[model samples]
Target: MMAPEDAALNGHETDKISVLIIDDDSQVCRFLSKIFTGMGYSVSHELTLTQGISHIFSGRVDILFLDVNLPDGNGLEAINTIRHHPSPPEIIVITADDNVDGAEIAMKSKAWDYIAKTGSSKNFRFALERAVEYRRQKKASLSRNDIRREGIVGESRGILKCLEKVAVAAHSDIPVLVTGETGTGKELFSRAIHACSPRCSEPFVVVDCAALPEHLVESTIFGHTRGAFTGADRDRTGLMKIADRGTLFLDEVGELPLEIQKKFLRAIQEKKFRPLGSKTEIHSNFRLICATHRDLEDLIKKEKFREDLFYRIVSLTLHLPPLKDRGEDVAGLALNHMKNQHGANLKNGCIMSRPFMEELQIYDWPGNVRELFNTLDRVCAEAGEGATLFPHHLPEHIRAFNIRHRYAVRQTETPDPETGSFEGPLVPSEPLPPFKDHMEKNKAEYLGHLVAVTQGDIKACCRISGLSRGHLYRLMQQYDIKNNADS
Candidate 1:
């Protein structure tokens, strides 16, 4: 028998394609196992129909080489039951009985292919290959649909791991707490969770705790009766009520006031709350999803957030990894963001420079996705009729930070004896780049100075610099030089 790890790494794919053989004859099982195993399939064999059915229901097998005749029972009798399984493996029936009626019966039961044991080995090989190909195509189509339906992008391990948790969370009814830095798409993930859950058809209500005023927090959340307060002229419904039989997403949930935490806790626990100035309490059935960057544990120690409230809200948690930690995902995200032309405010068709994209990967995005998108938006606008975004198109601070970070790294690797004992990062007098890159950098600096001195007067700069309008614009594009405030 192949080791479990070896079996799992079959073929070029990370996940092995599994094949199961159901044959009472030990010699036949051994003969078929060699062929399937040699073809890079994880193979298993059982001697009886019951054992084969048990293996099939375990869901590990992708394709089954089922023998119609078994010692304990006939495999043809259980074909319908196996075919109807939720994740049934494709079946290829093989038997020496050479019974035409049995082949017809297997086909009617949805067996992928039927073969006679007396058939040539070549024909059997072709049948097994077709069965595996069918399984692969089916799995690929389902995987693609799953990726799109999730609305989450990125191939980083962190993102893939988070998505696994999201899928698991969707099956159960529990409070989910999403904790991440601002702009890490907490609300987006929360929406995806709701969309995948059982209550997806119902309303998905959002409550921005940070945006809610302290004075109106109670009335806004629990609602109020007619003439309850100075401005309560009519009866109003609360967000919790609107989210009944659905999901309630509380963004920046940590900003919720401490006084209201107890009331929120009780409402969550009892599923009932009394609106302001209302004589009777109303019931609401809503799934809770909360998101915040704040650490509830630290807040709990300081009494800023109630411990009971924290426990009530955090039945499960998902933390989004910061952009810097995602490695190649930064470049992937930058390109993907540029391709999201429909929702973007900036014009499309502008391209990003290799150097600019490299800098994007190097810099730590403090504001995460939001900051990256904002920078790209400005770059797209400043690019004008130009095709590419260069380092000069970036905000000054980001460019400077990139250069400083690279210089610091270089200095650490090859320290100057004069500055060996440094007080802080030694700022290089000049930016270092290869010969070709340096020439472009020099041209961009000169153009930037000329633009600043001309005060963005393009015609004047063209005349003063003794260059044609076409030539100057071309240089600006080549150097990624942008003079406007948008740059």
Candidate 2:
């Protein structure tokens, strides 16, 4: 291991600027370290290129101060090595023998600044301060450009409120828990959160906690070395490492075993973990997002889930609204799904008939948006070609459904005490006509009553009958129905 030196803070925590001084001269390294230390900077120094590279790769050293001469190699070449880091530090080439070639090499290597050892202290201070400020500004700009959320569809109060929380959650790097019933698009929410985060470019790893078996859980999540366990023939990287420096989403998080939860808690707390049989630990810096349909609180009470792990993961929470409660968003979602499937090929028109729209609004979507999309897609396919989606095209159960009055009693007849006969709500105006004639007369009366109620609105009448407007008008004329609607 290369040498590592860190100054102890006196219990005071701040975002201290870290500096690495790489020089072969012991006196110069110590002197420069003392100068930065007195300025409230966290300082470390390495006498060799190997030690400097090791320190940088270990995820420390924000700014690097390099010397032209090293025990093992030239410091100018070390610029290429330093800049290769995933998040490289700003470099300042400080050499006693600065020359034209060295300055050109430093600029080509993207060095932040070049300072000669004989340069004044004021010049050195100016370059270091400016480099740190540039780093800060770059980070801020990257975050500002990262937010880009899409795919969510809803404008109801419940969904609008949830979106507000989602926007707030995207700006931070903390664990978020999204709770909702099945088919509520939990995974889509996870993707939206990732797209709107600073780590958007990084991979978005998903772990379906409930789908993995007990035996393969550890191997899949924490990886294994070759011959580390039985049947382990090759090196495998864990999902945690794959998700390093990005988002790790755990769907159905309630299904995680208590034992696995304990192991995960420690790894998450330390940002480090080891393969099943490995000795050295691997560090994974991942933003977490967990989703579950089951109530984790109830699982905790039943001892099925760990309460401690729950608190560790649920730093923020957002709950999605089911489709039944989204009101007009249901119509909007249906239109979107239809347009997506039909594209521009819906030449005969893909509009839903008035009856179909009313039925959709009143029906309780127990299966949520997933079920709604499936039902619509099925109906459209079964409709064949050139036939618009009408209420009659809907599934039998959905088309037949009618919302009953909440307070209306059942239409049961009661016997009167004064007479040994039953009472009916209505009496025939005259003796019933012949059976066939009676049916025709009743149908005409009902059609006239429908026209009256709808105030001659042909579209409204067709919606009530689940029939075409032309059919309703023909029936009205055949029945000799005459009302103010004709005027």
The best candidate by lDDT is 1
Task: Give all candidates' CA lDDT scores.
Answer: 0.81, 0.78
Q: What lDDT tens digits, residue by residue, belong to model 1 across residues 1-487?
A: 2223323333254457788999999888998899888888889999989988888887677888888878888888888888777878989999998788998999888889988888788877899899888887776555434532343668898887667557645767888888899888898888888888899999999999999999898888899999999989999999988899999888988999998888999999988999999999999999999999998888888999988888778777888998877867888778877887565445547777798898898889899988988888877765554346767667867876787787677665644589775453555667767755755676688799989988888876664554568998899888788869434
> Mind giving the per-residue lDDT tens digits that candidate 2 earns over 299-323?
9889999888888777777788888
Against the hidden reference, what TM-scores do the models get? 0.64, 0.54
Could you tell me how far off, in angstroms, the CA of residue 410 lies in candidate 1 after the best superposition? 1.7
Model 2, CA-based lDDT: 0.78
Q: How close is candidate 1 to the true structure, as a TM-score?
A: 0.64
Error of 1 at 212 (Å): 0.4
* RMSD in order of candidates: 10.1, 16.1
* Model 1 misplaced regions, further than 4 Å: 1-76, 82-151, 342-345, 414-487
Worst 10 residues of 2 by lDDT: 1-10
